[model samples]
Target: MIEKELPLFPLNLVAYPGEELNLHIFEPRYRQLITECVNNNTTFGVPSYVLSKIEYGTEVRIVKLEKTYDDGRMDVRTVGMGIFKVLDFVSPWPGKLYAGGTVEMIKADHDGDVVLQEELFKLANDLFEWLGMEGLVKFDQKMLTYAIAHKIGLSKEQEYELLKTTSEKKRQEFLINYLKLTIPIVKQMEQAKDRIRQNGHFKHLDALDF
Candidate 1:
């Protein structure tokens, strides 16, 4: 297994590859961590602190440093590079105040069968319409799963499962199954909402012949 040492930033949410995330850094240890990354043009690992553990995560790169407060807080923009599995965790890495660890990078397959992708896109389009979102889905094929994973209704655990998935076809199948189960419910709820909207409207009644 290929492994490397990285700075660890554990958060309560999952970060998927190709998704841009903005963060507000307030803690002292994290502040130091970000400072080092900015100064050295380095990368960090964002392990999701969910399922009561920190094992899987995405490797992240600092895209931009938006702001730095007078007291050391920072606003930074980051993008997920890829996924990684934590192998060893160190509370304080020798001299640093932040955590560090050895992580094995997870290889990802972003391309799936073309037919399967088209099917997924069709369902995704219908889902967007039901939720009142406009525009056709035209994301890069390689990054499709990560791009839309957040927009659909997924719990933290579900998102983590998607992150753990390494095969494109498997991920596509996973999303397709979720959409298949969810679309009908969303459609029914929308219909119910429309019926509720007609509560105050008047209707013409047909006259019965005597």
Candidate 2:
């Protein structure tokens, strides 16, 4: 039932909660939008861009305004706050330079299946090892999905699908299946690379002592 008017920034990427997204602001409309947000201490929304339309988005608040260029462009550091679904869209809100929309907040569940989380963690670690990644980022029930979203190699559409899912358990299951399918394929690729690297190597010969 959470509804509010949020400034919408449509992009081809998905922002997950507890994740930091750095953005470059150049367009005049968005520059105005960012400036207003900074002045009013308000947050904005980045609706998921899919096939020339926006349906879902994450509400984000600027953590810091990193830089302001001479041409009025800027770089900002922002963090995602929550998932939202756009209920209505308005381009150029009245006299404003930016687009906005009424969005309904999608509640995320915290109580996911513990056993499933543990299993997924193991699979993720294994996949990381296969990919030659050192060390692991600790994951908890609260931010598990966001922490692993990028690590699982999900496509933009798949990540958006993950963002749309409201239930924690359902998201966990979805990621687990994705990892299950991807891990073996990555493993095969790694093995093939190893074989190619050994292509012209000499083998030790055993003496025939018959």
Candidate 3:
């Protein structure tokens, strides 16, 4: 439904659709890439570089070009439009300094199971509350994965796994499993931290009822 050969920006992190990532364009190739996208009002592909290969990426558009330095570098803000799978890589992009690639946009299902959505929020809120980030997630549209993907603790490979999965229910299941596994450990860590903080405090010990 969009351009097939989009400019490629391979980075160490994963880019999820509907998320905003601000980037500094210091490299010559990327500067050209950002400039061209701004001029054409086009979208580019941000394939995550994992294990030294490019497979999956997110399609993003330059919504705003915040600044252009005197030296020609730029600071631009981009929002991910959708996910994509690279079909082919074009190094130097046939007259471009940066890489370009043929990619097919992968559709993300926004609808999630209501029960699962609730559970995801419950668990997410627990983690956030413990971390003092209680209001971080706004869950709606049944897109619980989108709401929690970036915020929840997930490695780059784990994030890419989410991108590979197109089903909403499955993604929710994956996240649920993740949270169920993670919350206990986080709870233990928090408990240990509290104990550490209370190390020197004098406590009024009530008679222990065993």
Candidate 4:
């Protein structure tokens, strides 16, 4: 396990591996942390929210940083790709939402299989059309994968399960199953809506004559 002390950013949402996160640094302490990461060749960890603080998070690398103000406020975008276990943490001194934690990096298989990639792309395209989100499809493999995964409505825990799996083949299989289950439900809902619209009444209501 590769262990390192990393600054933690607690968010209301969970970020899965191979996902992108955008943050605006405004607080003084987070501003300090951002400055440190920018100055040094360093990455930060984001743990899944467990109660108050996150005990498991993803390691995020800074991709872009924009200086917005003379006094240190900035806009930044980071790509989260690695899963890490949080060992310890310190509370924000006061008026800060972020925390710092000791973490151990978890290695994952980066060798994605081409076959699985192609299959996932196909399923993603099918899902996009099924959900009537065809215009949103980017056709880029990575973006498509993430967008479909999110659109299929995986829970935070389920997303964590996907991130922790070290096999690309396994991840691809999991995504396929998820889409299979969710797509039917979405289609059923659409059908029910159509029925309601045709009858001019809620689906649960008995048909009545005017």
lDDT of each: 0.91, 0.89, 0.85, 0.73
Question: Runs in model 4 with CA error above 4 Å?
Answer: 50-53, 70-72, 92-98, 112-119, 139-148, 200-210
Error of 3 at 90 (Å): 2.1
lDDT of 2 by residue, 103-122 (tens): 99999875788888888888
Scored by Cα lDDT, where does model 3 land?
0.85
The digit string of per-residue lDDT tens for model 1 on 1-210 reads 679999999999999998999999999999999999999999999999989898999999999999999988899999999899999989887799999999999999887878878888788888989988757555444457778788788889999999999998898899989999999999999999998998889968799999
TM-score of the candidate numbered 4?
0.77
Task: Give the candidates in order of lDDT, highest first.
Answer: 1, 2, 3, 4
Write the residue-wise lDDT of candidate 3 on 44-127 in tens digits. Answer: 989989758888889889889999899988989999888888899989899999999899887778777888888987888888
* lDDT (10s digit) by residue, model 4, range 129-205: 87788867575665434445665668877776776676766777888888778778878888888777888553576
How displaced is residue 67 in candidate 3, in Å?
0.7
Q: Name the weakest run of 10 consecutive residues (lDDT summed) in model 3.
A: 135-144
Report the Cα lDDT for residue 65, model 2. 95
Structural similarity to truth (TM-score) of each candidate: 0.92, 0.93, 0.91, 0.77
